[model samples]
Target: MSNLVEVKNLCVDYITFDGPIRAVTDVNFNIKKGEILGLAGESGCGKSTIAFSLMRLHRPPALISEGKIEFEGKNVLEMSDSELRKYRWQGASMVFQSAMNCLNPVKTIEYQFWDVFDAHDMVSNREESIKKAKELLRIVDIPEDRLFDYPHQFSGGMRQRVVIAMALALKPKLLIMDEPTTALDVVVQREILQKVYQLKEQFGFSILFITHDLSLMVEFCDRIGIMYSGQLVELAPAKEILQSPYHPYSDGLGNSFPTLIGDLQEMRGIPGTPLDLSKVPPGCRFAPRCHLAKETCHIKPPHIHQQNECRLVACHYPINTSDNRDQLPIKLTQVAEV
Candidate 1:
């Protein structure tokens, strides 16, 4: 598949009166055409920061310090305000966390869709815009008549579906869904994800799905990138990640989710809090919490090493190594210097 978006050495920081807090550090990943790439991590791990930076949506206090964000061969970070305006929504759209609540309380659903169409000059007349809006709503299993109803009239799930419809209005090439199902019930979340999968199949658009749900990501996404302390520690096929995680943090995250087929025991989450970015510890950010951490791990940062053509891991002593009998022998190849 062709690459839809490429993010390299991406770093983001929040400027405060005290100093700058590094939110994202030296992150690297890509989303392929018609592929769903999932970013999973705990809260404040910079998953959302990376999402916002991709679309140049980071407001004051948060700023892109260094990086390249390329979408379809165009450099997003270098685009002018005018270029950005044209690129956003039309090129790529973001379905933000709590997006269902983003609907204007006073405006009818139809008006909101019209506003999107108007902003992008997508329709010639109001009737045409409404027609497009109704089709979008229908795609999400919403009735066309609801377009005239206010935001409060719809249930939370229905409102979320409406937000998804709005995001798909332009048929963007890339869709960034930042915890789109965070607040929804399990049934509603599953329904929404199914709808999104169907839409992706129909539209052939790539997706960047961000959430803390590793199990959900394993089920829904083609590939998964595990983030820790503002950096991508592991990137690999979702099945491989779920079955045999390389990074200790990734293993911890995978274990944090309960398995349906395995012994239904209590889920043990990763111990220790995430490091403070402002006063980041030397060497590996995860070294302090890693059970397998060695003296070398505490003195030098591990470079991203390719385990195979499709997998990358940044860890001095990854889990499931040859010493462990459960996994296959992993051949490490240097991909990039840290």
Candidate 2:
């Protein structure tokens, strides 16, 4: 399948008073037509940064220093603002983090919903706009009556449903969701995700789902990309990654999450903070905490190793099937068969 969106050699640098802080490195990935690719890692892993960069939403402090963001065979970075406006929602739309709070408190949900249509010149008649807004609310499983209510009047989950409805108003080909359901309770989150899953099937839209919850990503994503510091350390099919992670950082993340059906225990989060972008160390940024770090890891970051048809890992030691069984770390062994 051809890629719906292709990002190549992407890098983002944040200019501060002290110096430039690199938030994203030479990252390259693609979203195939109708594929849902999950970007999983901790908060500071630059998942959201990449999402923002794609929309050219980065502010003055942050800038896309190098890369090509291609959408439908065109370079997005070179597009003019007027040209970009045409693609912003009709071609691609983003459901942001804590998007519930992104709604305008003063405006009624219906007004907010219609504004999106008006911005895109999709609706001209006020009555027709209201009718469309009601339809969108129903699409997201929200009550039609809530359309007249202000954003502040609804609960967080309810407001989130409104935002999602707004995003779907255009039926964009690509939907970028950055923790779309993170603010809701588990039951609500599941319900919203199920709706999103249904929407994808119904609309035939591709998604770039970004989240730190590996378990959630595993359950929802077709493929998963593991990011450490600013780089994509691993990318693989969800099941393959869970069962046989090759990168040390990826292995550590897999081990941190408890099994959903077996144990039902609290997840042990990854230890230690990520490397400082301004003062990034030489070689691999994850070298300090990686258990498999070696002399080679100290000098340079390893090239991504394509182990099989689906798995890719950037590691000096891509753990083979048989490698010093006794010397292998406990966490690595446990997740190797997950």
Candidate 3:
């Protein structure tokens, strides 16, 4: 598949009286056509910042200080307001965190859909807009008759489905879902994700699935990128990441989730808090918490390097290598108690 979106040397900073806080630093990754790429990281680790920056939705307090965001060959950072407005829902759409509550309380479901269609000039009249809305509702398994009901009338799950339907109304090439199912219950989350997977299969639109749920990402995404302290520490196929995580942070994150089938491994929380962005460590941000950290690790940051044909990691002492695979489990166990 061809690359659908490319984020190169992306950096986002928050302007504050104290100083600029670097939220994202030199982040680089790409999403392919018709593929789902998951961005997994803890809150405040810059996952959401990257998602918002991709569509130029980030505002003044947050600025794209340095980077290039390219969607299907056009530079997103350079687009005019008019071009961006046209590109937004038509070329890309975002299903934000807490998206269920994003529905306007005053508008009926049908009217909201009409607003989307009208904004993009997709339909000429209310009748046509309603027709499109009904079709979209049907796609998400929502009853078409509910279109006239107000936002308060639908259940939380139903409201979320409505948002997903609206996002797809424009048939965008890229869909950015930032914790799309975070607010839903487990059953609802599964149902919604299943529906999303089916829709992706049908529409062939690529997805950037952002969430802190590594296990869920492992199950749903084709490839996964693990972010830490505003940098992508690891990137690989989901199965590969699950089987042999290279970065210590990635390994710790995987262990944090329960596994039903594997040997019962202790859930290990990554030690220490996330880096303070305002005064980020000089070398490796994770070295302070890494069990394998050496003097070199604390003095020199490691650049992202190809681990093999299918994986990449940014760690001087990566785990699961032929030389160190034997000691990985022991080191992980020791780190778990920290």
Best by lDDT: 3
| Model 3 TM-score relative to the real fold | 0.96
**Model 2 stretches with alpha carbons more than 4 Å out:** 263-269, 320-328, 331-338
C-alpha local distance difference test of each model: 0.87, 0.82, 0.88
lDDT measured at residue 242 in model 1 versus the true structure, 0 to 100: 72
Instruction: Encode model 3's per-residue lDDT on 42-126: one tens digit a residue.
Output: 8889999999998899888999999899998999999999999988998999998886468999889988898888888999999
Best by TM-score: 3
Q: Each model's RMSD to truth, in Å?
A: 4.9, 2.6, 3.4
Residue 217 miss distance in model 3 (angstroms): 0.4
- Global lDDT of model 3: 0.88
Clash tally, candidates in order: 0, 0, 0
Which lDDT tens digits does candidate 1 get at residues 181-249? Answer: 987899998899989999999999999999999878877899999999899999998888877788988
TM-score of 2: 0.93
Q: What's the true lDDT of residue 326 in model 3?
A: 69
- lDDT score at residue 288, model 1, on the 0-100 scale: 89
Which candidate do you rate higher for lDDT, 2 or 3?
3
Query: In candidate 3, what residue range of length 10 has the lowest lDDT sum?
Result: 329-338
Q: Please say which candidate is ahead in TM-score: 2 or 3.
A: 3
lDDT comparison, 1 vs 3, better candidate: 3
